[model samples]
Target: MERTTLFHIFAAVLFLYNLPACLSRTSPNITTDQSALLALKSSVTLPPDHILVNNWTTTTPSSVCDWVGVTCGKLHGRVAALDLSNMGIIGTIPPHLGNLSFLVLLNITNNGFHGDLPEELVNIRRLQYMDVQFNKFSGQIPQWFGGFPNLVYLNVGNNSFSDSIPQDFGNLQKLKVLNMKFNQFTGFIPRIIFNMSLLELLNLKGNSLSGNLPANMCNHLPNLKFLDLSLNELEGQFPPGLQECSNLQVLSLLHNQFMGHIPSEIGNLTMLEKLYLGFNSLEGEIPNEFTNLVNLEILDLQSANLTGCIPSFLFNMSSLQWIELPYNNFFGSLPMNICPRPLLRVLVMAGNKVSGNIPTEIGNCTALTVIDLHENNFTGTIPEEFATIGYIAPEYGHEGLVSTNCDIYSFGIMMMEIFTRKKPTDEMFTSDLSLKRWVSEALVNGVTQAIDSRLIRQEEEHYFAEASCVSSIFELALNCTEESPENRINIKDALALLQKIRLEFQAKLSEN
Candidate 1:
């Protein structure tokens, strides 16, 4: 019996010694994940009464899985995703977040988060989707981003990231959507990025990226549906191989320095819906092959120095909506039955040498909202159906020389119509009470009375900022519509002031 008691005592001692090790193996994983999340919470600066302030607590280890933006995997009970998007959280990301080994998605978009992304994020090898756009983050995109073999969607747009795009991005063979737009990135687009065959949406717009596009830019982008390189300094002839991207739907290369004939091969994109190649040095007639784009909705070739007759086929397209060929050298009469398609909305042929009487059949286009035919050689009385709405500038009545200032006057009227949602020819207006006069009087009384009610209803948080912005816009419009051409604000100055107003409005919004 003594021997049996000694055996029992020895076994109990061993059990006691191993009990702590067993508990450590089973419980430390959850404890470690909870600690990591707490560290992240402590690092961020939350807005007043933020949901995280109440929801993310350490009362229990299992409580983290119930936090606002945290998602835990059922199998392992580990955090699998962290989505703090639009939460207005500010601060540098804590390195402890790298402990989320099971994380497959991380989205912190539209916040005020600033600073370089933590290099420790390389530990989240399973991350497949990441969006950090519309923030204030700055610095070089980390090269280690290329190490995520499973990454599928990535967007770092609308931030202040600078320097050349990391060439290591080429290693993301599975990437489908890559957007780095509106940042300060400079230098040649990494050639290897074009080799991402699986890419569908590649938007590098509004950057300072310069260099001739690679000759074989579209050779491998077979799935590309949306390609926007607009507002850049990129220059060169159209890549002949772009036709290889048969699935392309929207191609926007506007406001670049490209100089050459637009390749006819562009017509091969039969699936294309919108095409914008304006504000470039490109010359020559639009390719006749463009008629093949049966799905085309918007075509913008303004300020491209293109010459020749405007194609009549452009008006006949059943799906066409906006046809912007302004500020070119096209000279010809508009098709008499100009817009047979009811979907057509905007027709801008201003600053061209086109000559003809205004088409009466344009009345058939019930959806038409904008018709900018200023600075043309059209002769004859304005169509009663077209001009009775009071859009005609004063210079037209006096046979004064047509100038860009005339267009400015019309632009002012359009802005008024857009904000007030009241046409110049509205029943409320008369010889004494014009749309401009009504808006001016309302501005003096209260700008909100002239602003669209929808704008006020939708932006309650930014009511003051919106009101101020609208007031400034109305004041600018009044300057543009001064009775005498000499008194009107010049188009260039008007544009600069409008941009300034936008910046100030954005600053106010951030403050709010």
Candidate 2:
């Protein structure tokens, strides 16, 4: 009787101790959520080859937390991170993913994930970085998004996300870089964005975002470095208070509806490197204060209604590389003493009202690749000594009326510069056949002969080579600058072809 009582007591204790584990085995939240996961697994059939996991041979009855790219927290064994980037994932985002309350980082960038973002995702309170860019995601961003107090970096760019930015976004004080570029987002700039003081890089380019940039836009964020509002319906002059953004580096306002002269004080941005104000209605002379921009690299005022001479201020910028002022009303002579800085690469001043003899000093710009002065009122004999103007012509001399042939000659020079990496003036000329003529002859024989010897070593021709892409680019250059203007390709076609060649070479390099 004593042995029976002792055994019964021990069994009772064991049963009582294991009660919680027993209850958890069939709990509704656990079993119900497991069924939901199974349903998600069935809704979208992943191809055999597309499955990223090696350990999980089948989707069967395994826990979702143990799946590839799904990380689980130690405390509750709940999903904490889902990194599904570049998996070529197709099908809608499963709302069942929100069942994991501990989920933090959700990255589905560079995939084919489509349809509306499920509202259930907002339950992920600890989410930090949500990257859904480069996908086909549509519909308005969920309003509950702002409730994710810890959300820091959100990239929904390059998608079909439309409608106004949520006003509640102001609640996400930790948000830093919000890239919504290349989307169909419309409506006025959300007032909520202006209140986010921590934002450093806000890119709304390539969207339909309208309304005047708030006058005090930069007043809230002193730490901003890159502010790209280009290719939008944003009108009104660049906000005057942007001067207070002392840390600003790149500010692109291209292809917008902005009018009036660019604020003269814009030169106060001493740290600015790339300033793109092209394709806007900005008129009047470039601010004289621009001369103060010592660090400026790219200054693109193309297609603006800008008037006056190409500023002498530009020639002084030693760090300058790209100078695009094409299609404006700029008039008067290019500076006579202009000597390009070593870093200078592109000089596009085409389709403007600039009139005067083509400056021979242009040949002194040894670093120049592109010198586009087409469609201007430029007169005088296309500088005959353009290939090697040993010295600057004494001011403007008695030169005659120029024809459209000047563009052809400039085109030839640009092509030679890109290939040979030598200025026309750098002892490259002596005979009647100009640089263009030499390249033309080589192309006729075979482009291999025209390849810049600098691009290859003495005896390494048979191995891996940059030859094929270079050959194609060379042929393109030869076709662009045909002496008969009618035979030459248009600028648009030329640029597109060059870009294509560049991409081809880039792909080759990446693969190797």
Candidate 3:
């Protein structure tokens, strides 16, 4: 008629101009990938008919991205990593996850997820590792996360999230590992961790993080290594730019209210190993530059209002093992080379004023186990090589107690070093009577001669009531090492008979 009506009006304007590049701006018949997964389940908090859309039907949303733990990443094939860690997946967190702009690792760590955190995920420009730590996530940490330019590992630690930690995290220039510890985060702390130069492991320990710190924060984290600001309230001093962190190893400042005097340049931390300044208000001494902490192992300065002299270069710390310098004001006399490391284990110089004599080179330490010089002023004799060594001498043998069964032979030689892991001498030969008379002659000649054939485990099979709960905790460590301190058993009835043999060996290791 008019050239077939202008070829049916130019084929209906070329089918509405290829229908929005083949559909969906919001819904042409639904498709721009089903309206980008219903706009990512309407930005998650899902509920209404939420059977998580049963295999995302609306006719196969990108081939059901492999159901269940749904992990799918295949650029040329489609879908990208969405690891739902510990998926109990509760609400929040769903600004359509920035519509998975080719998501590259988004692990919703440890479930029960609560709100905030969705600043449209900084529009996920190819996101690179975002672990929503512990979870119940509250607000404030989202300053468009300093525009995550290929973000590298950001964990929202423990989570209850509060504010102040966003000096735009110094614009995470390819940041690496920033864990916000036990959160409730208040102010201070954001000098951009001194300027996070390729940072590595900075755990802000149980937070409430107060002032000071950050002066060069470990010389700008020169590849920082494990810095846990223990229980917080953090005050000043102490941050000697962590001696420019030459691979600093575990420096925990326990409790707080830190007073002065411990930085004799902390002997320039030669790969310092575990130095916890316990409690705090710390006063003098102890810094003979800690005899150059030669990879020192565990030196907890307990309660600290400390006064002089227990640092005989810490009895020559050849990799010293576990020495908690108790309650302070420490006077001299107990380090007769307090067992110069044959792997010395637990030598707590209790409460202090320490007057000498227990050192028979602590009976050549054969790895001493737990030696508390309880409330000291210590006089002589008990060293029948520690009456054979779990010696918590609460005024053992009183009135200058000249050893009549020395604190019941140092609690039957710390119950034969907790049942024969052995080491209690001073040469009383005669096959020894201490370790409490060989566990009452192995429970009257039978309960397998006081166990500890190195606590037996010959190809694990035995369960005679789990070997009679280790021979009833070696007869409650032979009734608390009795040499007859009025027939022993006291440190609160030997800790309620070892908590009733640890609840009968944890109810026989839960029935095998």
Candidate 4:
């Protein structure tokens, strides 16, 4: 009888002792969450001695919530967020991550992660924000991504994802910011995406997306503020219905094949701040209606085959800052009363048919930093104020002649300034110690001594190769700035030399 009583006591003690662990393993929150996180840790290719190597161990006394890059919901005690941005972790995402049912945010930007995202991610229905930008992720974006009704921000930019964007993305009715730039997405933008009334920022730049934008694109996008479609193969007329986006602030459509006139209807966007329509096949004058954009800041229309005199109102707009209209057929002299706005900075009208004296009123623009008026019919000498800026070639001062060689000389000075990070008029330079003379003297010591220190790292493996490349550049600059125009290297030779230097430097880097 005593033996039976002892056996019963031992059984009760053992059951009591194992009760907590048994309950933990069986619970829906504890064991499942920890296992899911451990699966993620096992999947990624972390660096040796990474903090996650030590902090993400199950042997630690801390709970799963205490692991690196993991956050748990207080009430449910489930993983709610995982952010490992810029952690240098590599490898494909594991399918097991879909088990974190409570996860709302997943950010793995600026990593080396690659491969198609596991389709099981669709199970994370509660996901609201997902950023996998600046990674090597490839393959078609899974169509199931659009099924997340709660997703508000989605960015998969700077990846190699190809194929047409799925039309199902329009189902994300609550999505506010959608960035798919720098991918290989092709074909027409899905018409349904334009119907997303809540979308505020849409960036599809640097893709192979083709076809015309729908005419009714802005009709339902009432809240749209930023739209960028640059660097694509898209071709068609500029959408006339763009006026419907009353709240639109930035419109960038550069580097496309859009043909036809600048639609006057764009004048309706009074809130517009930036307008980029460069490198297209568009024609016609700046629409008079553009004068209505009192809030305009940047206006880029370079290489668009535009004709007619620049509208006078553009120079007078107080809000105007950047005015780039180069490589066009714009005629007529710059207005004497140009640059009324103190904010005017970049004024490029190069390769045009403009004539008459360079206007002195440009001096009114206190912020003006770039002024390109070359390859024009301007006949008079440069304004005295511009002559004093120290970038004018020496021949321009002595002979007062403007020729293509003078441009070559100026370009050499600019190149030296760029590599040395020193202005021609820097305080350290004087009449006998010009930037050109200083760099010329440094060649005897070592051209690397004259290079911008920020660009050089002696400890790097390719440091000497890079320094040799800089020396070649300086030699080319000196050739361009030879005293006699006849002795200067032509722009063609300079370009070829630069190409050779670049190839050689790349080869040396590969060797290292």
Candidate 5:
């Protein structure tokens, strides 16, 4: 009887010991995924300050469902996502992660991860969103990436990834966004890329990718809304491909080797809000067809060989806000109907040889905040409205009024006014006591005396030291406004002095 009882006790103990193991295997049926995750955890070496320190410990080894960054499928209890973005984790991506066959989204962006993307990633066939951007991943992107049938978003940008983009990417018919920017990719863009009619955003910016962009761009990419192929070596006449991209909102082709006239067919992209074609070899006039882009907001064509008059239609575009056409061969007069839109704010036309009178109608452009028309060949007597709107330099009326020194003197006077709140033509300043003379005496007495009382008494650090720098600026401004225009400090010298003063002021502020 005693021996049988002992035998029964031993049997019961063994059964209890085995029961926990059986329960563990059955409750979380995703052991393969759990092991893969644990393997991935083992591979990562956390930085000094990381969130994975205490929570990711082996204390509760089996239930990674409750772990940080792991989201599980409700029905199968399998890990469906692993997002370790911007975590400051340093390590190579472990291929074991591919074992999570149910993973739908995997994001490990802005980490210190390096090395090539493992070929095993092809096993994650369910992956629909994968972003490993802004990391140090290198070598050619895997050709097997096309195996992910459900992939909707893939961004591998800002990595050191090199080699040609795989032509096989065209097989991802369901892909909506493909960003491969800031890499060292080369060779022609695959002809098959535009065939994916569902692709809404395709960004291949900041690569050395060379060759002519396929002219049939608009044919297949009917749904492509945002296409950025900027800072590449793309050449040939500007693609008339925009004819089909009617849904396109933003098109940037800057810093490329593109030549020939911008095709008038660009007007076909009626949905375009921002157009960036600057820093290319593009020449000829702004096509009158651009008037069709009634929705255009920001238009930049700077540093190209573009010529002819500034288009009147551009000034009249109701939605136009920022217009930049600097460093082009554009000539004739700037358009006078600048306020037709009333939304016009930034107008940069510097470095062009555009010659004309300052439009007296400019007073109507109340939204004007930044207007850079300097370095052009504008002539005719200055408009009285300009003087009334902003204080004019004393030398503006003199011969050689358009010289660099005149601009410098004006800048110096503006700086003085900024600090002292005293304009050049203030009632307090008589013929003997000019704004410059009043400021110079204040500098002699102590720069603090001339500084605006509100500025001098600020509760911020280095206020006195800042006041002293302001006094020196006043001194520099006075030198810039010297009676002899030839003896005045040039703009270059004034800029250097200002930069030095700014640096000194910053250093003192930092010290406090």
Candidate 6:
């Protein structure tokens, strides 16, 4: 009983030293909050705007509350929030901060504060949001973090904390967002966290957290809207309960070791707008059920082992803006009715075995901006309609056009490259038989041999129309490649001839 009395007496003395009003009529809460601000101020160095160095020193009733990045209660006059993010300050956190029992939000992100989080932080019982990310804080993630009674948002990503995620984090009953990415954390993800039913966004990407995810990952966190597990060592088949997540919007699992067929159940995630599953070992054909994802805008499946003919339904989805399925083994011809409405923007499907000629119906994709079709077995001439649409350009690497009429030579070369599907620098052409000489010789015989193989298969009218267009363009290209620059055809004449060829070609297409 004597010990209790003495302890109370000592505590009162200490409070008086810090708060300056422990035994006086003034409010101890505001004084204590001021002292806490001073404590944090002591650790900060190189305050750029003199925000902390000048303003936070004076603790008078109106002084500290009006300082930068500090918010005080309107009625109680106690510090309730501190936002010091990206202030270019350096120093470790001070332990004296537990005095700010009223602090509800503390953000020191993008600063240089390092070392283990002070144990006193657990005393901030009312802290609802805390972000210490983009700092150099190292050491185990504080285990006492479970003590924050009201924390709802916690972001300590981009740090060096090397601890298994505290299983006790499940104690944060109000937590809706937890981001701890880019840490050195290892060991199985604590199963306790999945019990947080209120979590809506969980980002643990860029960590070394090994071991497969818990099988019931989505069952408990039914409110999750954005989940990013990319750039980790997570293995095993994709999480099992993913299909049950009906509200997920952005699910990125790229650059991991996850294998197995992409689940057909993914079709059930109709709300997903962006799905990234690249740089993994996933195999098997894309499920036809993907057609149901009418709302999906971006889908990335690069660097996987996925196979089967490219599905035609992908072109029918009006909302798909970017589709990246490169470095896979997908085969079969491109769909004839590609992008039925002209909403598709980027379609990257290079580094595959896809064959057959590109369809002329591709001209319907008016919104298509980029199409990467490199390193494939596509055997065909360039589509003349695509060239007419200004999508293809002539190869001028070998042909020198140094005169005022250079544009004329360029246009003519482009015209020839289009019909023959052979660029000027093609390997088959030696100096003795350049692309110019080769095309000129073919024109002397007939336009048939120089024509693109794809065009050769067209019906009678197209074949004859293509032959006439090829003959005229080939003759113009030869005139442009004359030994003397001045002898080359002028730009005006070349354009006029090209325009006539296009009109005749369009007429033939119309007849067909």
Model-by-model lDDT, in order? Answer: 0.83, 0.71, 0.67, 0.83, 0.79, 0.77
Tell me the tens digit of each residue's lDDT in model 5 across 1-512: 12322343344334333432222235555778777877777887976556677676567664676678876655555777787888888788788988988787788889988898888989999887788998998999889988888887788999998999998998898887888999999999998888887888889999999988777777888777788999999988887677778988888999999889988888887888889999999878999989999889899999988999878788888999999999998888867766865677678999998898978776566455456787889898765544322334545533325567666766777788899887665668776887788888988887777788887776866777878788778889888878777888988888899999999988888888
How many residue pairs in model 2 have overlapping backbones?
A: 1
RMSD of each: 13.0, 13.3, 20.5, 12.9, 13.8, 19.4
| lDDT score at residue 38, model 1, on the 0-100 scale | 83
What is candidate 1's TM-score against the reference? 0.75
Model with the higher TM-score, candidate 1 or 6:
1
Q: What global local distance difference test value does model 1 have? A: 0.83
lDDT of 1 by residue, 127-169 (tens): 8778889999998889998989988778899999999999999
Comparing 1 and 3 on lDDT, the stronger one:
1
TM-score of each: 0.75, 0.72, 0.30, 0.75, 0.72, 0.70
Error of 2 at 153 (Å): 0.8
lDDT: worst 10-residue window of model 6 = 389-398
Runs of candidate 3 exceeding 4 Å displacement = 1-98, 101-105, 108-121, 124-166, 170-227, 230-251, 254-275, 278-282, 285-299, 302-323, 326-329, 332-353, 357-369, 372-512
- Score residue 462 of candidate 2 by CA lDDT: 34
Q: After superposition, which runs of candidate 6 have C-alpha atoms over 4 Å from their true positions?
A: 1-26, 47-49, 59-61, 384-512
| lDDT per residue as tens, model 2, 394-480 | 111224333444444456456656776655455655567556666667767865565667776447743243766767766776676
Stronger candidate by lDDT (3 vs 4):
4
lDDT, candidate 3, 325-419, per-residue tens: 88888887876766666677788878989786777777677566566777888786656565333363334423334333444445545656665
Candidate number with the higher lDDT (5 or 6): 5
Between prediction 1 and prediction 6, the one with superior lDDT is 1
Error of 1 at 209 (Å): 0.8
How much is the lDDT of residue 276 in candidate 5? 96
lDDT of 4 by residue, 222-272 (tens): 988889999999898877699999988899999999999998988998989
Q: Clashes per prediction?
A: 0, 1, 5, 0, 0, 0
User: Can you tell me which runs of candidate 5 are displaced by over 4 Å?
Assistant: 1-26, 381-512
Q: Name the Cα RMSD for model 4.
A: 12.9
